[model samples]
Target: MVSQPHIVFLTETWLSNKIPSSLIIGALPYTILRFDRSSRGGGVAIIIRDYLSYSTVTLPSSEHEITCIDLFHQSAYIRLCVVYRPPTYSLSKSESLITCLSDIHASSPHPIVIIGDFNSDSLCTHPTPIDRLFLDFQISVDLTHCHMFPTRGNRCIDWIIANDPSLIPTISIVPPFPSCDHSGLSFSLSSPQSPSLPSQIRDFTRVDYSAFFNYLLSVDWFSLFCDCPDIDSIYSAFSSAIHSAIDLFVPYRTPRPPSLSYPPHIRRLIKHRDALFSKVHLPSVRILFDQCSKKLLFEIDKWTRYSTRKKLSRVNDLYRHISSLTKPKLSIPELVSPQNLPVFDSISKSNLLASEFASHFTLDDGCLPSLSSSRVPPSLSLFTFFPHEVYKSLRKLSPTCSTGHDAIPQIIFSKCAYALITKEFQSALNCVFDWTQCNQLSLSASKCSHIRIGSKQASPWYSINSTVLPLENNVRDLGAQVRSDLKNSSSIKMRAQKATSKMFLLLKALPFNCPSILILTKPMFFHYLASPFWNPHYSSDIATLEKVQHTFTRQLFYRCFPSPDYPLSLPSYSDRIKTFGLRALTERSVIDRTSSFGINIELTTSTPRYHSFPVRISRWYSQLPDSIRTAPNIRMFKRRLENHPIIAHLAKLT
Candidate 1:
């Protein structure tokens, strides 16, 4: 290791015409001389160890590859010359190189050492006698006199020629590094030292930080501040302002919120105006805003007139901008029809809606079905009534040992009614009618009733209100009697009781045609009297589960089911019940007429018996809708029912 050696990396030094006259050489721990030769295309470089001082001498024009490095060491001058010879084998190569070396040796005040690439075979083919004689005068150590292969073909070309053997430097051809084709050479001599390693490295030592960090954690962190006004409120205010501004850019329906009128162009104008306002030197915000609006309006007008698709708002953010300008000026007069404004038109709104809804329905040419006058919509037929005999036959069927009620006809009628009124079915009406004719009851009804039927149209239930014939009345009254009998007649009641558990199973056997109505009305059998079962949140102590059935009929007057039109379908019932419960009591007063409407039927005189029965009509007809319960009227009814001890206990059931 050279304790203080100059290390220089010379690049592109061998390329004659291709190489530059000047090159940058990095000489670590040394002083470098970056120079250019006047005659040579690639120049020679010399570096001296930093601890050494050197002086240089100018050489003759022919002397191109000559660099002298002088060092003051051991109180004497030590000079070194690093040289390079051209690659040609011509005599001129030897002449030029030898002349350059001789001139430097003659002029030098101290001994010189030359080390470089010399294309010559010295030991094997001795130097010409003339060159050998000249080199001997200096008595230099010609290291090239020995053979050391530096190339694949084993050529001795690299050499160190020195004036004296004792003053000769130690030289070794370093093993080739991966970077270059030639092996590197390192030469060094001892030198005195100054300060060695840096002080930062010497001073640092290991120390513990656990206790210090623990003390830091123990501080009362909350006490480190003074009270300040809330920052969150300010941030929220800014955020709301931004949201309001953005919301203005989105167009809403015609009856728009007072906000959302800020046109994008107008907003941009306002922002520009505000920026100019802050500058103070610019025009007033009012003037600047007016100018910007005029400019934007002109541009928007041009865009609207020229574009095929009418999207002026988006063309240049014109909607929100124009809206922003006029929003502040909005007043009662502007609300009528503001001029130069970008209001959402009906056409645009419809287009927007069509664009939004188009994804839901697939309508190709082949999708439309053939239309025929003979054909009828299923909705018309679903609700179409069977001849009167059908109901009569249904009425005659007795309750079974399993299913309490025959549900098929009822479910079918409900679905048919729904289809007809709601127009929700897609099948032909005549087909349904033809199918119905196949049934025994329908065939008998057709022979008896002679009701006019057609695929084009049919008389709806609502129209029957006007046909108040005695025969129709008798039929309706009979149907009502049948329903009432199912509820009141002891023999049928006993049969139903036996099949009560099978009622749900029977319901499954019924038609899915009027599933909505089935789902709506099914719960009424025992579900409406849900108070004790549900444990009415109003009061649990008043009614216990065991007493529920006995007390159920008493609460019937207070209880109500949904109207037939709304149907007691599960989803609708659930949603409506929740809505009714949450609404103000007065708002929820609308009566469900189907549950309440009926003539008073005194089925039982015993007060206890009345309490247990599912139906016990009050003496007074239930004339009013459920919604009309004012305090005074409610109190009056409460008193009236209370006076009747039987009703008083029933009211508590619900």
Candidate 2:
């Protein structure tokens, strides 16, 4: 007897980066899950190996259902449930368990396996209605205990219960310790088989042939042969027929136990049967070829009269159709015939008995059970499990462009700024130079004009519009005076100049690490943020706004992109964009929360005050390296105004 593999489960662990990485062993391939319920903390997770793939499910607020996927194949499905029963103190503990199981059984196909800490032991020691209901529910669902741990000790609270006894579990309890309240439970599956195959066989030589033949003679064949008088004579005279029929109908014989080893002839026969079963029985390749060949011959004849193109097409089509019939038809034959007979022969000794066993048995490793003794359901609720608001904001900040190309905002900003610096935009140069304190020689319109003659030179403005009394030099002098007036006049204005750190502000407020930003960023990130003005579609005002936004944000991200060792976290709303199937901008933006952090800059109202400012962290941040300095100031400012309950949230974000 060979031992079957195991399916395990466990959960409710609040995993953090602080814990050492350890592999869950004893069974192969362990699954680990971590979910925090809310900011306050209450989440459910499960780990299962094999059995089936896992998915998330959502339950109503009042219900505590073990949400999982239900895949149905024919009459049965492989169902595993990972349950997290809150400590006995919660009011709805039993209701949660019952409702969860009810939903699972109702929605999923069975045979079902529920593994986890139920926090209850036995019916005799049952502590709550939910535990009692679970027991009754198991009974109602026809579930049985193939095995349980601590069978002889105090009542078994932790369990691996399933709908089918054939799917019973073998459990090992991990010793309890002072650190954790509950003991770790491990479970394995038990092989479902009878001690041996039915040992019945039949023999033909000892049967009474004459009596059997006489019985067949009483059937209504006389009517069909009424017109042929020779039929009665043939039946009455056929002695060979009786013997032939008797040889085919042998009595069943009880098989004796099989020998430990096979004779050479028996092994050869077994191999022969296996080959025949593969080629002729299961796929029945020989039979398919025979049938397909006949069909093809008919099709060729039928399509031969069509035009040349038509004939060719029809021939190809028929060939493809005939080919398709081969695989499926062959599969049925292969499945019906027994391929491995020797294994059965070793168990039953008799060749005939082995043959019978081979016809009935099939081999499958019960769809790989879970690694831990815990039962893990297939699906979980994506919306409920992940942070929704933060994810939404990230989606807004990073979006697909009209052409569905990734236009990184930072890249766009850099390009625009480089262009402004290189291009001969006099106004732009004037703005930048004045702001930067680079006061140098200034060129007026008059200084830009010059003309030459045979013996003398004169200003171009005077040469073009001339009068003797109003000399060319005097006209140039007047033009120079006008240009200087424009340059120095207090009335001449500049585009409303506002110093903003909005882009940097957004970067500082990112809820998750930079990696999350990378994940949510799309080509549209560049299109809207970096080149909004370059798009002929928008007015100059809009374009200028876009330029400022792009410049600041691009620089911010370029400076703060996380180091390789420390990856950034994804914003919560990104889950909606990727996993929830919400793809459109309108859908993403309406509920987006990360918008404020997208560009990190804000416009301030023009106000003047004569008041002392508080001595705070902002002053401290101004002293650090230029790289991390701005981020700290923005963070400190935000903290001063609104103290977020989550302290050092950025640490978690990374």
Candidate 3:
């Protein structure tokens, strides 16, 4: 159902001149003809079967990327043209394209078909000048549009218009190619297309996660983490175990196509809009037509919003949604070498980077400050990681399934975390710094430091890799600042300054005055200020954290409100939050913690309660009713908990 088309007519390919067309087609029995847009937007291409005899036809203007070709089929010529008119395609350019198409139609003796995304918004009653011009040209040529179903978010923008109505007997909306939003148009022109082979993908849902976790737990991971004796063997054993688990558990199934057909009420609205579209020139009919069109478009938008909300409700779905919004990677063709030559090859580029880095370094003097060796200095160590700490970190891991250079997916680690949090796993993490055992990750000797907590003067010199470590009063690690005196006032002040700057920086960077854009982009804000679900934090710390959000809502109020004298007119923060159906960040965090605790309470029962977090978690869990605690998933738990007195005051924002 996905890839059955012979002459694939693709609109808005966005192919630029930089990429070679040959690279895209690969070693296929098809030839591609593309009109690439130089800067951005409005690119189109058509891939035809190489066995088919076809000749390219020229248009008068090169303002838009359009493909026109004449195909010789059974001793008769079929003039086929694929054109895309972007919503942003200027009226003049639209007119030019139509004029060119008109002239070509006037000259050609063979039956012609112009098919592509016109961005005409077939559902909208009041059409733009471009849509009208395209329609007028279609009417002039006596073309019949065979796009029966809506494509491109409630609008039948993509159409296959033919001069001879019988040329295309039928058309239906099909699932689009992977990564495409617009649905596919499958139509017949004398011959029916062969059904595409259904593709198979790993059915992750079928895999028994609980069983897999238990299997991994039963294995003696001490061999892999500590007893492997070498880095290479450790890596190999880890990889092998992951692969073996996959072979034994995960199953494969053919992917199912998503529903393309819209609701009947929407279909009715579209028909009504199309019917009134003919008499849009009449003022009285135009009003009713526009009302119908607005209602239809609003309905589609409403569902689209609901889908977005559903995505943001869960961790996995949120990750997928974020991935979808990621911008296209910028391509840099070459790197400059010392010789002022362009280095295109990967090896040369790596060499250039390595050489530059190696050359740019400060000379280190082979000297050490003399110190008293009589007294031994105390040193902090991470020889063992507590199970609770490991479990806490593991549960926070997003199952995006993204892998680093290790070739192991995060989902594997996350889903199997409950079982994988063994003493051996803890050893593996602790062994990250143990150079004698697993020398996989070498610490930079120059960047290494030692900070003595008790004494102002250094006790003794510590050296690694023949380099002496520098003693410092203050050091920052993983975005947290630590002082030898163990004071946090300076760190708090620094954080406040940084936060203030960032808040102002964001305000200056974006204009939230436009409520429409702000509403559309509100999900991003929710993601930024996420509900902390791990454990309940101190009230003081929570209040300090809430200041960030408090500042944001304040800024948002001023930016979104239109009043000149805003101070007196503005409502209190609590009222404002309630009006927006949003809860305090602390409230959200508490709810999230309770919900997470409810999901893992049974699994964590055997785990030793070494930390105060578990005690606090139990207290919070006790507050919840039996129904809320027994809920199947975190999503359900949170929903059920929202009705309790603890979280009932907080409204569901989405």
| Highest lDDT against the true fold, candidate | 3
Query: In what order do the candidates fall by lDDT, top score first?
Result: 3, 1, 2
- Where is the poorest 10-residue window by lDDT in model 3? 375-384
Q: In model 2, where do residues sit more than 4 Å from their true spots?
A: 1-8, 15-35, 39-42, 48-76, 89-93, 125-131, 145-148, 151-153, 176-178, 190-654
Clashes (backbone N, CA, C under 3 Å), per candidate, total 24, 61, 0
Model 3, TM vs. native: 0.33
Better of 1 and 3 by lDDT: 3
User: Candidate 2: global Cα-lDDT?
Assistant: 0.39
lDDT of 3 by residue, 70-103 (tens): 7766656788889888777688877787788887
- The TM-score, computed over Cα atoms with residue i paired to residue i, of candidate 1 is 0.26
lDDT of 1 by residue, 212-327 (tens): 34544665434432232477755665565444443433333333222322356645654664465344333576366456546655655454344412323242343233233222
